[model samples]
Target: MHLSKLFENSNKSSPKRTGETRKLFLKKQIFCILYLEEHKTIADLCIPVGVSIPTMTRIMHELMDEGWVTELGTGESRGGRRPVYYGLNPSVRYILGIEMTRKYTRINIFNLQNKAIGDTLQIDIELDNAPGTFIELKNHINQFIKKYKLDKKNILGAGISIPGLIDKKSNISYTYPNLGQKPLDVVFGDLLKIPVYIEHDTKAMALGESWFGLARNRSNVLCLNVGYGVGLGMIMNGELYQGLSGFSGEFGHIQMIPDGELCDCGKIGCLETVASGSAIVAKAKQMIESGTNSIIRKLVGGNTEKIKLPVIIEAAHQGDQFAIELIEESGSYLARGLASLIHLLNPEMIIIGGDIAPAENLILDPIKQKLNKYTISRIRQDASIFISELKEHAVLLGTIPVVMNRIFSDEPYINNIHNFNKS
Candidate 1:
């Protein structure tokens, strides 16, 4: 499905013209440039996006008048008139980003310049109950707006990132059983009375990295989300490469040990079962249950229910032999999975994200050791592997780009900005 049609204004009475479309395209192009750079003159934007000087002037004037862009002093004159630099007026517009996982949901508010404006709120949410879940999310947004004293009019829209297969064309999440097969945007848009954008959590992370993190200039980067379940997000040729049906990055479900551990996805011996945080915790519990002497028993204080990823990481940091072994084992399995990814995608960089990345050197070292042993020397030498720069906030920061693309479509850019200002 064409993205343009999803956001097409149903009230338009006439067909769009090439000139109008070009103007709209320029608007988006300029916004992206300003977002990436702190300040840029009209001449800088014109050269890169391939627009004329007169066209840039018109677009800049419209943006400035609509309170979306601001003049940021003059630039060096190259034997000509000094060019005025312009930047996105971050305070004039805001975006709400929500990143949902099985254990919790993280929410953040960012402005046009992508600077976070308020304190991020992390809440525990149960995905099993859809109605209560959305209600809680709605309340969180309302409270956040109230806390920040933000005018609803200034909000561009909200972006929701969920783990699982997302049909971007339909905005539906197939893995979220409670959401059924309905498009998430349609449901959330109706409830919030604002344009809502939905994407796979890992894909959103990849976009986040591209826009504001280490992968900014690098294409063909792979973002691996190591959470309750491992997932992959691919950035190929400078675009988020969501495969057919938008469920491309299911690397976790890739079979590693056939007929071994059972996966929640109804698959046996999937990579996630052996490599994810849950897998580590599960292995620790099994070892403790078998009367093995380990530091995890003392760390959890004999309470199996309290065992978590952070606890295991902390124990490993404190030189707990058993905890270290568990993490190293999981890291080995993760490297085995990544080795296959290296052979297939030939990505320039591989980033490990999500909650498990905080393990830092302990997990990273084992992963690198196994990769050196398993992968071809050529691939290992070229592809750099590291933890995510955004750390735990990658998915939350990703929401800004997603919401902007959905709400600020080709036509009616000014109108949308005005609507936001008036709200």
Candidate 2:
């Protein structure tokens, strides 16, 4: 879509040479929606939105009058009077996103600008595909909305992220049994009485990083979700790469150990067995239980059963040699898998996101070093690897784009505003 085309915003505005002017409702609507992603002044919006200063000013005024835009003070002075900037009126709309993984489920509300509101609700519930599971989740959503005092009408929609196999075509999770009986979007939409979109947890992480974090505006990136399970979200040609059945990006299942350790998928020696959060905790527990002389034992009060990924990471941070070795081992395994990815995709960037990313150099440094050893020099040089700055919030916040895109696909924002004005 050459959506960059602008239109004249006023009757007296001149026609543009290429892209449309802001005068067309469709042009102005899309441009304004893009601008809501970040604050901007009329002049700042011209080139990208393909509108002239006068046209942009007129469109901005229209949006402001409709309660979709607001003045956010002025930018730095270039010379005389500083130009006033504008941002989205966050309260005009809200989106909810829920991220469910093997270990826990996190749900939160966000504004158009991707700023989360109120404290995030995180529960230790594992994901299940049974009808009762969604019923329980729907109840939670109701309570959360009531607690926040959010009017149901103001909430536009919701986004849900889940781990494992998801068939986007049928909206059934192959990995989550009992949900294949019906289409998931319809099920959730009916329960919530609002639109709902679903995506893979790793895909949600990739979208979050692409929309609000490190991968913004970049094409051909690889986002590795390094959490309890290792997964990948591939952005190809500036879009998500979900192959047939929407079950792509299972990077962890690539065999590395060759009958090393049995995986939860019933596969032996998958990369996840050696490189994921579960692997990290399992390895730490093994070392402690086997009397490997690690401070993790002290952190867990000598109870190996109590050991978790965080305790081991803390021990590594405090200079525990055993913990450091364990992390390095996992990083090495991860690098082996990423090395394969780099050789095949040669992505512009490889982003490390999710829970364990907080460990930073403890794991990242080793992964880079292993990449240097495993990946071709030319390929490794092209892909810049880094940790996601959003940390734990990436997946939960991905709902903003998911819900917004769903709404945008159905009707133009101008029409929605027109309907809002009528009521």
Candidate 3:
């Protein structure tokens, strides 16, 4: 609620601060009031930004002139005449958020208020590690923007969330078609003709949960994006913790079974082999072929290759023992893997999202049962696992925090953000 973007250790105020500094400070204050917080009156802003009512009013008027803030209807009645509420003018800027997964690419257009502006589009395409893959993906985005009739300049930027080990400093994908280790943003941004930003899909999910869902305002939290492969995102002490190489949260590749099923990551018996959507489908196929007494066999018409996470979840919901057992088995493996995170981070909550999230309690209950059995009581007590409130949209909504964090946060002030942890 401090509202100002100044570094914590810097001088709080300078009446003599001249020219650009004063203007930038004023903009940041107005930005917090109109964008971060709900409808604000001049009085609502004074206390937080340390400005007088008159001064705040002047700054607000200036922001309005710049098309950043707009006057809404009056606030609630309080006996006296109500003050006018100021809100952010959403159309002043828009952001395109793209979430690319193994099976589909989703595009969501968001206004400055972080609210969806149009129908979310899901393009069925595989995010393959092949030549010209990014080009094809970019073309789909072009068609999407044109179909929506969006103006090029009005789009502030586009944020991409992709499945890979993305280096934060270099912005290069260590896991995909970098085409000579070039930053993906450079290649993709050139095609989009706007400033582009990219983040790991899991990290984006964690950001979405933190900003708009179950983990709102939570400092120490873990977010697991369980889809084709499992990915983990850690918010340690109030900041998203990207490891030194920005590849910290590789949840899927953790070795869970030694010398077991081979993983796409070129490893054997990784956690992904047991808990990911692909893993669930693969296991379900084997069970169907083995004459497992389950509804999934009938739902897919005995086509083992047609089995997917959704069908398995549907069969489980119908009380099919085989489907239930398979999900329980996956959850148990996931819980076993997460026990390590609980020990290392001691996070307050763990938010799970992606395709498996819709299974809700059917999938979550087993994971909790495993945690209860395996995790130390003290460590487990600190964290409560929650299904993501944003559900399948978590990855798409996550693009908001990723781009916003980079856009608004000063690099120096980012470090100044305190990490609040429990002992």
lDDT of 1 at 193: 68
lDDT tens digits, residues 222-249, model 3?
Answer: 9998888999989898888888988899
RMSD of 3: 4.7
- Model 1 lDDT, residue 412, Cα: 53
- Model 3 has an lDDT value of 0.81
Q: lDDT per residue, candidate 2, 235-288, as tens digits? A: 898888899888899998989887688998889999899999899898777767
- Per-model TM-score, in order, reads 0.87, 0.83, 0.89
Query: Candidate 2 has which clashing residue pairs, if any?
Result: 6-20, 6-21, 7-20, 7-21, 7-22, 7-23, 8-21, 8-23, 9-23
The lDDT ranking, best first, is 3, 1, 2
Clashing pairs in 1: 153-420, 153-423
lDDT of 2 at 360: 89
lDDT, candidate 1, equals 0.80
**Model 3: residues >4 Å from true position, as ranges?**
1-17, 47-55, 76-81, 129-132, 411-423
Which segments of candidate 2 are over 4 A away from where they belong? 1-66, 71-86, 130-132, 409-423
lDDT, residue 270, candidate 2: 94
How does model 3 score by TM-score? 0.89
RMSD of each: 5.8, 7.2, 4.7
